[model samples]
Target: MTVALWCILIAILLPYVCTWVAKISGGFRLKDNHDPRDFLDSLEGFGRRAHAAQLNSFEVIPAFAAAVIVAHLAGNAELVTINVLAVLFITSRLLYIICYLADWATLRSLVWFVGIGLIVSFFVVSV
Candidate 1:
């Protein structure tokens, strides 16, 4: 129950976290007046980064929900583990978004894998 709630909280908050990352990454500008090329480049890179984060959430959130629910149903996966994993997933996602925007390809992918792996492992163990 607590794990499900925390997952839900993190899921809702993750996108905003990504947006904040983009802002910090210099993707956000105050003025509309700027070079088209710069804007295009920023948009492309930021778009991809944001999309990657979104895709990660899409991949993991449902699995997190399913795993927690299944664990509850099956009488396994203690609340502590589930909540801790959920926090870990959220942290990994934050790291992934920052790494993506920073163009740290290897680190980004690794963070993504960790997040997805956490969810997938939960799925396997829950079932």
Candidate 2:
């Protein structure tokens, strides 16, 4: 249960972390003339990657959240299974963020698949 809670916490904070990375990456300004799209477009390199990561983070949340909640509620999984998988998923997501920021494309994609795999496994256990 605690592991599930921690994973929930991670999910909640992940977006803010991504947003912070995007903002701090570089090339953003407070110019009045720029619209949202232009402001986004002005970002380059790290900022651009961070922005993409931010968007990607949003994309994964629904399925992951559903998997965790449904599986946990179904009560088929042992505590150890839940805890280990939660740790693995969270760790993969953390690494994915780092890899994205570092522009490690290959590693980023791999970790993303790991995260997805973890989520799907969660669902599988529930069913």
Candidate 3:
């Protein structure tokens, strides 16, 4: 599969990674599984931020996935360019998560904008 396609998979899985981080930091247990949303909602500090990041990750997936797929279908952008942008988007997400966990609000927002810019770039390049 193309690297961009692989990135779609990574993007899909990223939220689960963030959720795991939140769960681990929040001391999730088997009982918590019965009310996972409540358990996650009750987290604070890094745990809470991680949960927020997880939700944000999920929120961005449709855009990222659609961007990648549309870019491929449009067939205007070079494969390498699409691949690089996809990698950069994933990198931005990882950094965003780290910034969220570390409470770097400004940096996280900047990284978020970068991710959004990358998504837009995919469409632009496809034109």
Question: Among these predicted structures, which one has the highest TM-score?
Answer: 3
CA shift of 124, model 2, Å: 2.2
- Candidate 3's displacement at residue 62, Å, is 0.3
Q: Which pairs of residues have clashing backbones in candidate 1?
A: none
- For residues 55-126, what per-residue lDDT tens digits would candidate 2 score against the true structure? 888888888778778878989887678777878888888899899999999999999999999998987776
**Ranking according to lDDT, highest score first:** 3, 2, 1
Model 1 residue runs over 4 Å out of place are 1-4, 19-42
| Order of models, best TM-score first | 3, 2, 1
Q: Model 1, range 1-127, lDDT digits (tens) per residue?
A: 4755677667767766655554555556666235523543455566657655655665666666776667567666776776677777778877877787787999988887897787776666665
- Candidate 3 per-residue lDDT, tens place, 6-122, comes to 999999999999999999999999999999999999999989999999999999999999999999999999999999999999999999999999999999999999999999999
Candidate topping lDDT: 3
Estimate every model's Cα lDDT from 0 to 1.
0.67, 0.80, 0.97
Name the candidate, 1 or 3, with the larger TM-score value: 3
Please say which candidate is ahead in TM-score: 2 or 3: 3
* Candidate 2: residue 31 lDDT (0-100): 71
Per-prediction TM-score to the true structure, in the order listed? 0.67, 0.86, 0.98
